[model samples]
Target: MPPALTSGWSRVLQGERVLGEADSILKFVPYSDCKQGCSGMLYVTNFKLAFLTADRSSYDNTGKRNRSKILGDDDIPLTNIDSIYTVSLSGKRKKMTVDSKMPTTETLEVHCKDMRIVKYGFKFAPKDQNKKFVNTLIHHAFAKKDTLLFAYEYGRSNELKDRELICDCPMFDTIIDWEDELQRCKANKTWRVADVNMSFDMSQSLPRYFVVPTALMNNDIQKAASHFSDRRIPIWCYTHINGNSLLRMSAQDSDTDQPREVSRMLDAVKVASNQRNKPKIVKVEEKCPSCQEVQESFVKLRKICMSDTMQEFSNQDAVWNTSLENTRWLLLVSRCLAACNEVAEEVTGGKRTVVIQERTGWDLSCLVSSVSQVLLDPHYRTLAGFQGLVQKEWVRMGHPFQRYLSLVTVSEADTEQVPIFLLFLDCIWQLLIQYPAAFEFTETYLTTIWDSAYIGLFDTFLFNNDHQRYHFSRNEGKNIKQFKLPSVWKWDFQLGSEDFSFFKNPLYLITHDEELVSSLNELQVLSIQGMFCRSSRNNSFTTSLEQNRNHSQDARPERIDPLKKDLLVPNCSSLSIRLWTQCYLRWQSPAQILSGGTPTQYLQQCVMVEEIAQLHHKLKTLQLRESLFVEFRSKNDLIVSHQPNKSKISELLNSTALSSSFPFSPGPALKEKQFSFTPICSYIRNSSLDYDKYVDDDWTGTL
Candidate 1:
């Protein structure tokens, strides 16, 4: 390779071997954004597809070099590529699929899982080099073999040892982790941790150790597990304070076989819990939105999100409301939320054990089970608890991440490609919006997790099951280098300590309140009544909210103490289910504001909240001291007296909130010490101030 092909800016990671390189590759920007193309050198490595410009400049939408040098805007992990299409630069520029014949093309369009569209033109390159580049990309990028993935190679390397330390998430990777979780939830009395799947002989999908009802013997478990698909037995996911527990399992493999053994398993679960009522078997396939339906809705939504031109976006915008409805994404959200609420009610109020049953017990099962826990158990609402919940419910339960995420090309049909996890995140976002103070984590945390899913380095979301992960790491011979795969829970690897601080919700308080339950009942009374169905007459997302509200007005439940009640259900009505614009539309330059967007607003709020907390602490200290005199003319005077110094606020924000990565950065720091304190003081004064004009001059900008 010549010096021209060698990259000065982009460096390959340890164990990341470059297979092919092509120079004079023209990296094309969207015509709506920029007309000119930049010449670059493209390299296809085992780990990633890296593109380095000759000038070594990778700019953001703001025309600033804001991206990191190692994995800049043009560099995409091979695992992130969703699909690839080819276009001719010579003639009509018709896009065609990359088939076995290796079609001659001048431009290659790469669509990524992260919603990034990167186009590279080969018009100036030699035909042979172009063909080689295309071949290398297709062969390695879409390789079905698990060993070919970077996780194994990188795990075997020395670099990962240092990188692994930054992750702070409790991986829930050991049997002890599950035991600890069960004890935390007070579930150890009814459930016992078993290593029935120790060698994966019982089930390939299930983790080695999991909790099962203590009443059942190993023989009974083995007999019962044989009946269900992938041996996804009714395992304990969560247990409420009321003693009713949440369980998840797959439907029986043969419908005609009369699932007598499975019934016995359920009986054992009920017997162990000593509940008078029978367990509620929620057929998730029947109760919630189907994976196929979720996939269809996501595809339509993605097409709308990836609009290439202003004209195309406008065309979609004309019927944007209808388009969103047609996608049925919100409808699916409503259904999932409704299902969670139903399960939560059963487990908490009715004291009935709820068993979530699906075909494979991973996709919808994980979604419903996880969401219900977040709603019913206040522990899961905390940041650490939420991570553990995901680890146990989703990762340990074995949601087919490789297939659902489209990490690698499975088949031509793209059969299992669905955003089930994304849908779960969106549903959580809706809850976070409705009850902002309830969750310990911010929306930025959820979005960051979604973004990290495609990074291809984490072992957390790489495999379909513990079996696959085990096999991938297991080296039979001494000659083979053992692969080290770290958990995605170690978030420090993806974000710095300063950036990670943004994940903590400033609004969250340590004390429980009655408002949560009161709001839940209020929202439930106003919620739409029906589950989402695909009939033409029944498909309108918002049609039932008004009718339901009127009918349920007289049936509103009396508010109770939140300490006694505890659970907080969301208003999952169609109108309440919102599009997560911060996650989906963050990339569109037209959608972004002049200053920082919601993240900046959040930063300002965070700073003010911190100041208020300090003030409260001071007041408590003053009370303890029995101060002789205190100055207070009016509420306004009191607030004004304690208003945070502008310089202090600026310095505080710059050091913390403003240091986050793109899409989350709070923009530039406040330069002027004499800046207006109106926005910061608005919350204290209860002012209905319009800060839009002050925040951004271009307030009329839109996508």
Candidate 2:
């Protein structure tokens, strides 16, 4: 029966050899809330844990023959796993830990970093097969030593030898990339690149090369390092054209008094930023919400978003506002935005340099610094610039990725695993919604990055710092000539150009610096209202554009000058914060709409815009050809009956197909398909659109 459950080794990466494989494994249905189980083949590789159903015919009907199913939605990256458990027949779950004894249970459950839970039953397997498989999975997935990570093994492999190495944006791995970024921001005027930590002897967490105040000496940096946690010294993040700079550093060591060297370093940074005033230090622990608060709020919010049954969702929907408010997620988001705005105001309006500090300087420190730059700098709003910003602030600066987004099982008491990166992305999404054209990237880009963090394919989000990545590769993986790890910025390997096109904002427009600074006063007012009021006037920049488009047949988004400075700062009011449905609710059937909801509408608009652009290009080419033909005809006495018609071309520009198919209305034939398992690491789209027909990519699945 069921073709004897074929081996799932074909679902793994080229270099990822299977360590263990078991047939007749039953996967508990995720969509059914773990009520039913289906027989499948379970495979554990160095990279991931994959489960392929015995009956794959229904899914294979998609007709993708050549595409490599290296990693499927049913697979979970070993590094993305959060916790593991042994499930008893009596419905009792015993949490698995590094030191805990392995149970001879027939069923097991895995919890992931992305708030997903998957269960599997090991019934009908050979004697001791379950124990052998469990031991292997735990040893590989929860590698105690950094050198044991699959990154070292995969990095040393020849899988990528023949693939073209191309990246759309800078990986920021080299010194030259940092230099270029400093030059682009004009921070070089006051800051200079420091390489005191070249061998990671000074600070293991901080990058080898980073920018610091020109006035600060190497010895001063050394002395200052002792005062802060993780030795993450005050370093340049971004610079304002007004000579005000943004800096980040870890909080002072507990139970210690402020030292003289720390004072000297702060003075140097202040003088470098502005000769007149001292730098405004924003203590994240004091000003913003705590990591514990964020973690608790997200737990409640996720429970609401991932409701198991239709009745459960309906009940939650009846008092959705109250339930959401109880979670304090929006409240936390509002507080975070308010804190960022204060820093923005100090840097821009107050004309003072700002230094953001938090415990260990990785969590809240990274969040506020990045969000402030988004408010003050237009460059960071662009896709490439934002990638560089994350590289500089989060990855290079060391955000404890392994600790926060852990590979191994986490204990109930562990609070280190916080969603700081996701929170930062959420803040960026709010800004994107308030000012759509201001960003070169879409919300999809942010969501994609969130998914990429847990994928484990890229080493970008693998280690806690550069020190670990460097030493681990050098000590364990000596096969590769260069110990270079793959960066997520090289996205061409993961997705096609057409899929990549979705990340680019079709309505993107660059605004003048004067226009960016012009709305400061208005922003100050909105910032105050956002903190106190439940509801504020809907001053969305896109509102007028939408209304104008509704009135006229061919009305483009108006480029309103000054952008209403108030719009530059997001409305942090609870009512203003919309749920990121494309991310959190994408898996829930009850939460999903028939035509794929707002995200699909947005994607459809992006498609329409690209089509219109292509048509315009074709029309221009035709006109150029016609002009050349006429010139040749005049000289050679050649004549043709067919002539390019300008009027007809104009008529073609007004085609009905170019109209916005927004709020994505579907036909009667487009019915919702019930999925047996929850899809992960896949972009969900409107099933009715038949998007795969053109793209033919399996990763981009239908809803």
Candidate 3:
């Protein structure tokens, strides 16, 4: 027989001593060399996967000149491997490859994310052995739980490496009842867990979607499903009050709405297999116009688009008009959306966890699931919180950001980009008009998200989604910092007064004395879920910019609070003016600069534009406040209900230091919850008076 899998070792491979992989096998695969020129054998012990060359300096163990292997000077650890697969003649390649290859010989390609895919020609002599080598390598490659596990699972595996998970690992207590596909993340010694105070025994269930109180209870079940032998996974759950939360997923059209479970197992499996892309993280649509414009976003905001009164209007003779069919269809959509909203409200407000799945579990599913969080959580009402929500729910969760916006082109066909996120913004716009103070960010912020989203200015919004982007990052050997990714909002903005607003959403604004959230406008509900394109003639709502201009005289400095002097905001619409002025400020003669623009000019323009934006936000904020507290003084409700945003205003331009300690609390809605700030500390563990006395090298204090 060939050399044993663990043969040719200088010393006995004791795996358990390595990193708690005590029971794991010590696998040895001997090959001529890897494409990275790792000549010798691959020794996969518990601690790491190392490539060791045949040692020439052999130590004679039994007083015999027996050649034995010792540690090579240049061994490479394969601990951070992203993917390893056998390259069969698989019909050439998916993309063009510059290098030539023989159709017969098998090449074992190991794609380490940080670097390129290293190709190793298998010289195992036996084809079966080579195949087993590739298989065995992949088996241990994925079933790992080291610090790199999260990065590997999320960042790598893009090559579709097969992993038939063997249920050898012990399950977490929270997931005993969940499907096997819903595996919990492997614990890493360095990473921290949710605070003990924030975690609680979440045993309750409800019809509405709720955040899972326990960790390991929530997962990107659909995404994780693709990695397992069984392609079934539980729904993505999140932390919520009453142990309930809502999820939005796409579904089939009304024609084929229900499933024929009455069919045989094979038939059902086939049907289910076809719907694998469901629980879609982003809105993906096919077909469209050549050019898209910002003006196209107004259609979803119509009053009738969200209400259920379309059925009553369709009774008229005008209903037969084909042009009216679009309206009718939109109305029907609104009705369905309303029903879903009602159900969600019941569930979110009640104690039920709701899972809204459409034909594919994207589109509508994303809309409702995300919007539900905005409705239920007050933290989401703030600018920092809103950014956090999108990061967590859309970007981090995987919403196909790359597919929607073409990275290469500035613009594309209307149909090429999905306006799911746009629809969400428009819905927020309606909320802003209704609850002027509910969201910290204004219409300006929403408009900025749309404008910069396609430009790829920030890495946070650059990727298609969390998994696809990070997956590629791992392939390129990027630093996979746990619980952190590139973000668009700066520390100054997040901690500043510019992003703070004390106004509540309309439902909450009017009834602060009662329940947290009572109701929402049906029209706003429908606006949150569709590609609404309304005729310009029917667009009725006047933009806040225009409204502010008509009443500019009323907003004069003399008539307003002198406190507004501290506010540095300008009108949101005046950004173009600022841009022009800024560009002119750096206009060195055309002869001094090349015919093309200079980097200095571009950089200067960016800075000026940012300054204008900050000023505009302040202006709009102050304007809105004036309209409510001063200009609209006759409106008793507006004046009487102003919430003093004492905290938001205090640090408009201040840095939040990590060393500062405070008794942090998670707002009213999340009364029992605790916040996580890695660089910052909310409370000190040690309460003794001498705790602060030790200020030496061995302080041993964590912030």
Candidate 4:
């Protein structure tokens, strides 16, 4: 059991040895008088001994006092010491003569100001040894000086326990456990432990103050108990004593779901990274120029052939290779669909659909197997499918899955499946136009097919639409221009306008000094030129026929002679003149000549004659035309006096002097009247014609 409080104080005052080395001092000074009339008191305790200043003041002293009386320690209490300073005065001071130096020691001063003291109620150490008991006793004896006495604890815990005392001075405030108070203050965010040890003077430095959780007694406590640790601080323990509970509660209530979500997000990133593969270009030579041209010439020809084949199959007159062409329509539709899917996929981010129109001629039955294959693969199954079933009978007519299987079988069996493949592409394109949603889903699949097959065929397809407007060429003997689609056709499809008003509208009229349509496919341009030449030839033939008819009815002898020659010899000269006339007419401005509306036969003949006369005059100015005019002696100048010879006609035909010569071989001519007028008809063999002077002066001198 613990000793009683008064007994502990008495033991300490008796100079009993205490535990541990005494490193600190506890001094008490009293100023006020106790109820028993004490004046002042002083108490001082060291490691080995305790001492006090004796009270010596006289209450009945005379008013006039000498210096010696005043200087006496009369008011000093037994507990109130004037000063308490450490002394190390051991051994006698060494004396030195005039030649030797005296030993000296450095002294440091400490000043205590504002020394107002309040009494404390409980003491952890003994006083009087109760400094308060001695102070009260001394204060009653002296009345000259003021003193103050306060309760304080000093020394280690063992010493303090041994010297326990109950304070007799008036209690000002309860003694607080400073460590616990600091913990509470830290927990409430009201106080922080500050180390007051750092000072400018080396001797004045104090120990560092540390803040920590109350649950943590040592560094190992924080390590052992998770609840007593702080996550934010570098130290393993909480700096403030009261902060342990808050940190523990926070850790206990934290949610664990965040890491899982983060993990899933990371997985998604990894999957995305691993999924991508490098793209490669694949070459497919499916269509040759001849096949492409034939297809173009016969627009929707496959549909016509399918209808014919189906009709023949229905007739059943003969079982002659019925199934061979039976699946042609289906094959074509599949190819069309493939092409459309590929294009749509490229345009959209794998979110386009392919829609095929539901029609009897299309024969979409081939797609069943293909659709099934797509359905089998979980990823691609959702990517592409087929729709548009209007008839109950045809509900399962075109299963894409079945068609896909057929395609695989047919591809292995025959190398000439290109036409069928193209048809499939067409079907795909039609599907894209019809079903936008499905097209979007199958966009990636479509893109893959297009990259493999359709990319190089773009120009060929455009040239097929309007070959006369485009030009094509090959690079390294491979069809490089095959993908060069016409700008006009491309614009039509891209704009989704069949009329192509964007190119033809007056508001958007395009103009140029000389517009060379560079993007035109070569085949298209050649086809256009062929058509123009054919039209011109037909017009010339018709004009010659009309002239022949007109001359037939004339009954005149000269007319009869010409008609007889035309019938008998079929004059080459007549044919050459007719061709030359046509060429001239082609060069004439349509606006100027056609503005007169449709002319009569006679009027047309007159216009032709006049144009020929003007051409002759122009050629003569250029030294290209020769004239042979003569007057007959009589209207019927007696029977063939002078016959026009073949040499004269040959000379006229061989003449190179013509305004514009033909570029082909010339033919023979026939004699006409005695006064013969034969215009020169020589071929213009030059590769290039110089019409620069006729157009612009910039080319004047150069030509």
Candidate 5:
């Protein structure tokens, strides 16, 4: 095979290997290593990724190169790529780091792993072409990933190239099913939106088809914009008689200044809006572009006006500086979740769909939308809907579980893995613990999902995109139809809810007859526990919902004194509680060998508030020293003086107000659950039990 036929501007592919007709290979780039002087044509087919080696003396029928040739050995297996990212080729800083005489090249890093890591680096022509390549690579990788997942689940070994893909359709008919359900339920409304309850939000950032609130059609709205044509990505909407919302997932904005794209989003959101007018972009911040001179001036002036964290870079403090930059993404996700909860509350779906950007609308977008739905929509909590929710959101919406599977065992690299799915499940577990009976599945169900997220149990949850997943699952593979893959919920039918009582979350949310607004304050973020679980005061085997609810509703305050449960109960492995933390966590975290000689140790140490208080008291007795003097300012003179008061000082020193300033306080820790007092909120202050009816109350601030 001459390289010229496989590559160059005029290079063409017959694509005989790809089953049926191949989707057009839309883009191509010439990849060359400046140092090695090796060249190749980087092209992506519908089913596979192949790069043909090109001879530098490359002239094709198009007369582009001097002499172009293809090397068949250069093709890369797209399935092996674990993660891919690009390097910046712009900026004076970036330019200075490389040779000026070198070709404009983009560093493409592909991390391939099976039993070990095999990294592939491709230096493609043109600076900053890395962005386009990264997307193409990921999207293609996802397509291959879906094929592999479907094949694996169908008991097809890695070698089964002969099996045919059957479905060639979408996953679990969330959209199609909902459309029929909606139309049958309501004759008046025209639900042309398809699946709003589940779809991929087709913003630039969210290019993949995944579970979204509903899929939105960008092409329908704008025939003028070139990019917006025939683009029907998921932006599904689920409407209720009382209210409606458009929970959307989108790719990040491609054209930052594109008004037509923004207008499309606003229009789609406006469909679910309760407002009389359309919502406008609320510019949160503004920046002024600086010239080279201004940029240099700012750099020189940096010392005079800079954040407290800013300091001169030095090898001695390099360790500290590196961690600060690494922590930015984690902090950003936390802040975004907090802000999204607030947005969930103020959604004016009656007039406008509250559009909270789901961490730029992809992985975390699926999580944010699903969690928000569970809170707002009661349907998600149901048995059937919860299964649909996972199928639509986590499965259809792309959560790269394959990339995360490596996390089960410890690897040196943890940077590429995000706990989006884990965190989402944690949030749901909290709901399950709070409202157990409200869900059809038991604790076992949650744990099973968590485990599967780490293990490749079901293919539905593994694929990277929706469209290819649809094709792969149905039409791509050649297989016998009699051995059909079983439904994921087969375990539910096998074992009734009775046996999985140990998996139950203590809390239960009973559905209300009338739609009720769940509070934003209740959406609290929780931590990941893999190997161990924190001690819970309630230890009775899954009791009846009535019994649990009665205890949950009781107003009795917990005592600071240590409870018997802490001293009597032993620490248990988190395998029973949190699956990801216990087993999957083994790689990143090693199980410490305990002194007791048992091979297995408890997941976490059972630390209770009472035990903590006792330890604190013991430590305080040992560490607290008599302060010879205390500092105070004279009331009239703004001067501090050191004076010692013995008897009264000792009492004041022991008081919580004073002890609170100490680095460690061990006394019985106060918790929100332990507080029986009704909060003195704004409403309480202005109630019918007026201040005038009682004694003149002490006020902190003057009116």
Candidate 6:
């Protein structure tokens, strides 16, 4: 028979006291040993006492016992007696040489009433067979009511070697179930009701012994409770560590009689679970460029998702064709940006022009395109990627629409318009910082075209629609009322140039008010000069009075007092002289150097020469000028030399006279004496006026 089955017999024999002797009698043996008849054996017998006299030999100086006390026969009464039998034997034998010549020892049996061989075994097999011993012990313990305790010495079972001696010798039985629940509780270091029940009930001796499976002990309290109730076992649930009762019941109790305390305990567990299961909230800091606002706050994810307004705005289908929530979100963003702009404006004032452009939606292709040309540099590419990530994250959260709309509305509604403008300004600033030369080139191109063209167009539109005029009648024509129109000077015409003759003959000098003209001139000069210097120098310069120059025929000519110059060159064609003088100053090397010319100077000079060449060519094409003649006579002797005067003068100077005479003018001639000579006398005399010398010296006699 198996050791487990035999152990059960021992358990019945010992009954309630089985636990006391369990440690000694139940020795586990291996299955392999049982097959070989090498299994361990158990001895059981009725109690018998005996005493008998025996002779002893005296020992001499060795101080050693010559003979030990022999068995003495005596009679003793036995209070209890039980049947003795070989319950079980199983185990293997260790390797050893058998000698047939040596006498084999016989198994001995001693009679002891009230003694029993409840179980006995030897673990002589390989290490793997130890589980069988544990199984036998468990079987024995569970078989009989008196099985209070079970124990295996330190070296018995390899599997149970490190584990604590499992003592099921409880005063009462406790039920537990739910395999995973126990594991969870154990992992969390939590103590549940099963632990309480075992600790409380087992401390008492009412039932003497309790049998529980290790699996049951580890189960969840709730599951254990159901299992226990189904089995109709009285259970006293208690906490693991303190043994405090969570619930208590008798096997016969109705469901209504279930412990109220159990409900409380369950509730407590739920509370703990709720806390453990809760989602965490985190705070985020977002900076909106459009509204220039930084938002630092905490938001619950669920709340943000569930907001009706947000939902409405974010909805794809809406009458407004835009998500109202998105619009509001954008508005909020705009508000933030506006706030930021307010701060910026407070610091920078309205001197700076700001414009902000917000990109929206997942189609980063556009943003990528817009910034692609800009992101040629690795650094700009990195920045763009980072900003793109930020934008993408916002979009993922469904707030992209909100942010975009907020930026737009706030930008638009901005009375000062700083926030809206500042966004673009900052972007430009960033772009310039990232790619200075590229930004500069791009700005130059834009200024060359749009600044003038679009700005002019806007100005025209603004001026034409300056005022909103409406007429009202009181009492049906009893009285007519008129109000000044609303005017918005969108473009400052004062800053425009009259030379841009593409439009109506260039309304030069508009608004006859002298102060206004002066102001306008200053403004126009500033715009032109500022833009020109910036473009040419590739640097920014401040606009101020000190930086301006006075020039009569430059783009912005100095205001001339027409009366003053008329006296000096009365018939010199004042306009022509002024224009010629301006050209001369521009062409002079020293003046050009003083003006800080560069290789570009030659280019500018070439451009001027080209213009003059074109003008000359045009004049020639129109046949505007024909040859004019000037006649001169020698005041020297008229010796009747019939020289063809023109040919003679032409021969005298080799035609240089003809070429130089027409182009030059004679100034007021020096005072000269006239001489009269008789026609009959061929007299030769020196002329007082030296016309040849004068003509030769002064290319233009005006000099």
Residue-level lDDT of model 4, residues 449-545, one tens digit each, is: 3222211112211111111112222222444332222111132222212111111111001000011111112223567653532453225323342
The number of clashing residue pairs in model 6 is 43
Q: Of the candidates shown, which would achieve the greatest TM-score relative to the real structure?
A: 1
Candidate 6 regions with alpha-carbon error over 4 angstroms: 1-703
Give candidate 1 misplaced runs (Cα > 4 Å): 1-11, 31-34, 56-70, 91-105, 126-128, 159-169, 253-260, 476-481, 509-564, 613-703
Task: Compute the lDDT of residue 399 as modeled in candidate 1.
Answer: 88
Cα lDDT tens digits, model 1, 207-321, are 9888898888888899988788877888988887778888988888776475777778888889877786768889997778888898988988887777656787778779888
Give model 1's TM-score versus the native structure: 0.79
lDDT for 593 in candidate 2 is: 57
Worst 10 residues of 6 by lDDT: 464-473
The Cα error of candidate 1 at residue 32, in Å, is 3.1
Give lDDT tens digits, candidate 2, residues 192-309. Answer: 8888899888999888998899998788899899889888888888887778888998888887887888888889998888656778889998877888898888888877875544
Report the CA-based lDDT of candidate 5 relative to the real structure. Answer: 0.35
Write candidate 3's Cα lDDT for 95-127 as tens digits.
Answer: 112122223334555533122234454444245
Model 5 over residues 1-703: C-alpha lDDT tens digits?
3344344332232221322111111122212122222345455433234443454423333211111111122333344344544434551112211112333324444433221111233433433543344455555454323334323434332222222322322244444654553553241243353332123343222223222222245344333223332232325434333344445534334554545655565565554434455642211111111122222332322222211111322321356434433433223333333433443444422344454343233455566566656654556775556766676666654555554443222233422344456556655654554444445444445655554443233455444555444444554645534223323444332232222222322233221211110220121113243111122332322232233332232213364122211111111122222222222211110111112111011100111211222233334444433544322221110001011222222222232111111101111213223322221122122333222212112211222
State model 3's lDDT: 0.32
Instruction: Give the C-alpha lDDT of model 6.
Output: 0.22
lDDT, candidate 3, at 234: 28
User: What's the TM for model 4?
Assistant: 0.15
At residue 279, candidate 2 shows an lDDT of: 82
